[model samples]
Target: MLDSNKDIVLDELNKVFDTIDNSQVDQMVEMICGAKKVFFVGVGRVLLMLQAWEKRLNHLGIDAYYVGEINEPAITFDDILIVGSGSGESIFPLSIIKLAKKYGAQTIHIGSNSESSMKPYEDLFVRIPCQTKLYLKDEIHSDQIMSSLFEQSLLLLGDMVAMKIVQKKDIKDLHLLWKKHANLE
Candidate 1:
């Protein structure tokens, strides 16, 4: 039983890697490099990943902000939205995507399925193929085994992007990233 579980975990990890789109990653990097501002959002576990990206982007000297945070302005045409939602059908993200697009903001969405609603609306979609919603035999809270798995991948992916930016742009000082770290009392 343990072996089977291990195999399943390994297979899921491999599936996440296989679906990675290097070209889209490059495009996202380019967009971040060129955009006047960058905004990101995610409903749950993915939201944590988005927040991490926002911090890294800020460290890289990009104007980065997280949605729903105080004082963050609406995304405009010169901005980009990076969102993570397993279903891509979440009403909050879909509505925000549409509103942002109306203002000409570009969207980059990472989700479980390629055919999700957000897929049609986004300028770019990074599909993380997995069963996003999971449930235990008697649990009420969504298990999100796949979503959690994808979150790990997204974290790695974001770090990779940050490193690439540092290399391409000659941002070698680790201090820059540290400086962006929030200092709350």
Candidate 2:
């Protein structure tokens, strides 16, 4: 039963990724690479996934910080803000994305609904195309409860972006990333 459940989840993930737009992903990679710094915003499990992505970006020697972190720096025109909200209507993230835009920062929203309120504030929108709470039309149906599929896909997308960054920069030695890893840990 455990293995069967694993297969079901994996199949769902595969279907979700298969529907994602590669061009949007390419733009995300370009934006991340060009930014002076990257800031992330989200809530609940989405925020947790963003935190993991932030750490991975740091490990790749990129300046990445989450919005509410104590030491987070001021976001500027040169930086980019990445918001993860499957519904794209989350009040906090919507508010923050607007504020980031007000600061002249580039904003990218990764969510399931492209027509969401976040549309006006974000410079770019990357759709995950999975089942959201709103159950919008054409969302890929999921066996997993709630937004689990979306959250899991968000994490994998981050890693995919990280790997693309490595490829683009032509970092010959993967071991060199260790230099940026947390030393105290």
Candidate 3:
């Protein structure tokens, strides 16, 4: 029964990814690669996924940091901020994106609702097109509870971007990335 449930979840995830626009994803990759520094912001499980993405970007030798991390540098015109909020109406993320824009940094929002409050603040909107609290007309329905599908898709989207960076930069040795991994553990 657990196996069947797993399959169902995977199938749902597949549909979510399938519905995502590749052009938007490509634009996100370009922004990440072009930025002098990349910053991330989110809340709850969404923030957790952003944290993992920050780590992966670091592993790939990109300068990435989360909003609240210690010693985080000031965002500038050359930097970019990626905000993850499924509803696109999360209070904290919305505020952070506003601050990021105020700092002259480029802002990108990866969320389900394109018309959300984050819209005005963001320079780019990469819609995940998955189930969200708004119950938008275009969202892909999910069997998973709450915003689980959006969070899961957000994590995978980061990975997809990381892989694209690898290909675009022509990093021939995967071992080189291991050098960036935490060794203290």
Tens-place lDDT per residue, model 1, 1-185, is: 88887776666666667767788888888888888999888877778888988888887888988889997987889999888777777788888887788899999888766677776679988755555553222212222354567777778788988887887788767775776677883
Better candidate number, 1 or 3, judged by TM-score: 3
The number of clashing residue pairs in model 3 is: 0
lDDT winner, 1 or 2: 2
lDDT of 2 by residue, 63-176 (tens): 999999999999999999999998899999999999999999999999999899999998899999999999988898998989999999999999999999999888899998
Question: In model 3, how large is the Cα lDDT of residue 82?
Answer: 98
* Candidate 3 per-residue C-alpha lDDT over 73-122 given as tens digits, one digit per residue, 9 for 90 to 100: 99999999999998999899999999999999999999988899989888
Residue runs of model 1 more than 4 Å from their true location after superposition: 1-11, 134-146, 183-185
RMSD each, Å = 5.0, 0.7, 0.8
TM-score of 1: 0.82
What C-alpha lDDT, on a 0 to 100 scale, does residue 120 get in candidate 3? 89
Query: TM-score of predicted model 3?
Result: 0.98
| Every model's TM-score | 0.82, 0.98, 0.98
Question: Which of the two, 2 or 3, has more lDDT?
Answer: 2
The local distance difference test score of each candidate is: 0.77, 0.94, 0.93
Evaluated against the true structure, the overall lDDT of model 1 is 0.77
